[model samples]
Target: MRHFLRPTVALLFAALALLTHRAHPAEHAVVITTTSTLGAAAQAVGGDSVSVETILPPGSCPGHFDLEPAQVRRLLACELFLRHDFQSFLDGRLLANGVARDRIAALPAAGGLCVPDTFVALGRAAAEALAVRLPGETEALRTRAEALAHEAQTRGNTLLARTARLRGKPVAGALHQAAFLRWLGLDVRCVLPGGDDPTPGAVSRALTEIRATGALAIVGNVPSGRRLPSTLASRGPPLVMFDNFPPSPRACRLLGHARPQRRPPARRAPRIAPCRTRSSPSPTSPSATPAGHCWTTSRLRSHAAVSPPCSAPTAPVRPHCCACSTANSHPPPAPAVSSAPIRPHSTGAAARRGVAESA
Candidate 1:
């Protein structure tokens, strides 16, 4: 009876210790991240032991964001600060004033996409950073990080398999997410200029690039183009739009995760030859290729390079170019292909619908 009593008393003590460990919160480490994706990674890795905050709002562009004083104070007080190297160093300068400099951690410079692999990588980085700062919780943080990484990698693999059909499709994109789209196997034809409305010349150049590439869809940040839709593939591809970023750790709402009504495929064979107009031409600029009849027409129709009004009087449009010679006298080249064109990155900007498969 005495021996049994001793064993029961030992068991009771062990059980009580276990309960205390479970019931009490561990030391909490406050972490600050530049983006929500990183913030979520920190949260996943930190689990119940860390507090995570992101300075940037969801869907905001990193290039345009500025740090506020309150955020600066929070940043200076944080136990750990995580960011991607591509993020502006302005925040770093603010945090590096003293002993706080040691707290700053940057994941390797990457495209900073919200892909599953990216999230997993970020998780690993955060775990490693926190392990250094809070050595007591090292084991738990590492375990959580590994679990997150494995789960993310598994989902990423599935997404790749689902989107495998999109490979080699020529698509235009904003410079911001171009690398990710290319990784998904889309032939990125041209990278659009980033930020708000571009100038007329910029728009014209974009049009020229699109015509040159014969891209079928313009996949990019929504609101990328200045005078798109009407001036863009009006008679061609429908604009495919996507929002900038997911608001949470969950997969993007559209793209591979959700079944947004798929845009019907438009199969087109654009035959517009590249046109090189001189500042001033003597009647004979390059003519339509032997394979083409007439190449391009635009809303701003009359440039010198264009031929006179279309002989088809009631035709929907006439040809035009500025300051060039037209010898064959077939109307100036009208843009041959109607393809979807996407927009550049803007936080508040209504971005394009994503490839139906990405961040």
Candidate 2:
């Protein structure tokens, strides 16, 4: 009777445990990231271990984004939130919208200059925080983050190594990227915005520095176009517009590869104003054109003409001239003018004259 009671009690305990297990199932962590940059890294690290959602699309300023009802719902459901400088980003938006503060996690903010080094650093932090939230994914999350970091660092060093040729070449760039420019081995001489908005004092200082450093290349932010010093505009340094931010975090890897156009050697071919010849070719003949300066010069030589009139800059200057052999070009060649040799009064000269005369 005691043995029977023991078996019955054990069976009842097993049944109760099975019922409790069925009542609660494990849930995947829901992650919400504010920016695409952080969201991309989170996704790379989280893999399938966590469900990640992004709030801001690339290129949207945080101040401009107002949360919609659907987005707010998505945010409230998330178990974790990642943002660069989350305090300023979220403020009380999530809390006021009914999200518990405990679930939100702020990793260290990686600043501007979206090079691989910056991303790699942020990835590790994001992965670590995520591991804490989803203990079951600790190993996978940490491993993925480290692997990402390692690969990025490797790619960064390789990029730096490849850019060794740019070392010591002085440049003036957007204030935010001065350090990064130097890191890539560029010599940063003067920064733009010059502590000055085209102010006289700023202009004076910038010009002086430009002279001092011989900085012929001015790197400007792509977003802030044509804002260079007006005084320096027509005759200033070659303004190099740099796109600091790519469309997405995944594209951030392309940083540092942008380069300013190098002034072509002093012998760069002069720009040719597009011009069409006054004449057109016949149906049976394929028309040919001469190179710009060469064509102009050759025509001028033949015309013994005045300076080529400056052709009105046609809208969308097209290649009005196809490069062709001067032989096939317009203005057909002058027929050869041959003269018979003069006959000499004496012996050998007469023979030569006879040969020339074909007699």
How do the predictions measure up, each by TM-score? 0.59, 0.54
Clashes counted in candidate 1 amount to 30
| Candidate lDDT (C-alpha), each | 0.48, 0.46
Query: What does candidate 2's lDDT look like per residue over 1-359, in tens digits?
Result: 99999999999999999987644322346677765456556655666555555564322333334566676677676668787764455648878878877777776645543455566666677778787777777888777776666555654565455456667887776675565566666788877763225667766767777778877566544333333533443456654333332222221112111111112234543321222233322211111100111111210110000012223321221111111111112322221111222222222443344233421
Model 1: lowest-lDDT 10 consecutive positions: 283-292
Model 2: weakest 10-residue lDDT segment is 298-307
22: Cα error in model 1, Å = 15
Most lDDT-accurate candidate: 1
Cα RMSDs of all predictions? 19.2, 27.6
Q: Report how far off residue 317 is in candidate 1 (Å).
A: 34
